[model samples]
Target: MGWLHSLFSPLKKLWFRMHSTTQNKGRGIYILYEDVKSCPYEDVHVLWSILVESNSASLPSKK
Candidate 1:
């Protein structure tokens, strides 16, 4: 496991930084759901990104 993880240290850092929403802060760890209310506990991003949404708006204007 150590060897495997060593291979992804860069990716790990990027994932944590990007997805955590705030670098070096614990806001990434169940903080919203555990500390706040009025926010949906179900809607959360587990990682930095997911499947790309089709760029429907990027299509060139119709003729």
Candidate 2:
């Protein structure tokens, strides 16, 4: 597996680093590998919308 893996590890790491930040960036998203038991997509979406609305409300209005 060493030779087969060596050629791909760097590429995998580079891709992961490049595109993985969105999965978790402290805004309000998370990846639960384990069983979450709660907070399904709908719930998360509602929460996300709420946060966005609150944030937008806090911002000054534009003409």
User: Candidate 2, 36: how far from true, in Å?
Assistant: 15
TM-score of 1: 0.27
Clashing pairs in 2: none
Candidate 1 achieves a global lDDT of 0.54
The Cα RMSD of model 1 versus the native structure comes to: 12.9
lDDT of 2 at 16: 97
Count of steric clashes across candidates, in order: 0, 0
TM-score of each: 0.27, 0.35
Candidate 2 lDDT (Cα, 0 to 1): 0.68
lDDT: which candidate is best? Answer: 2
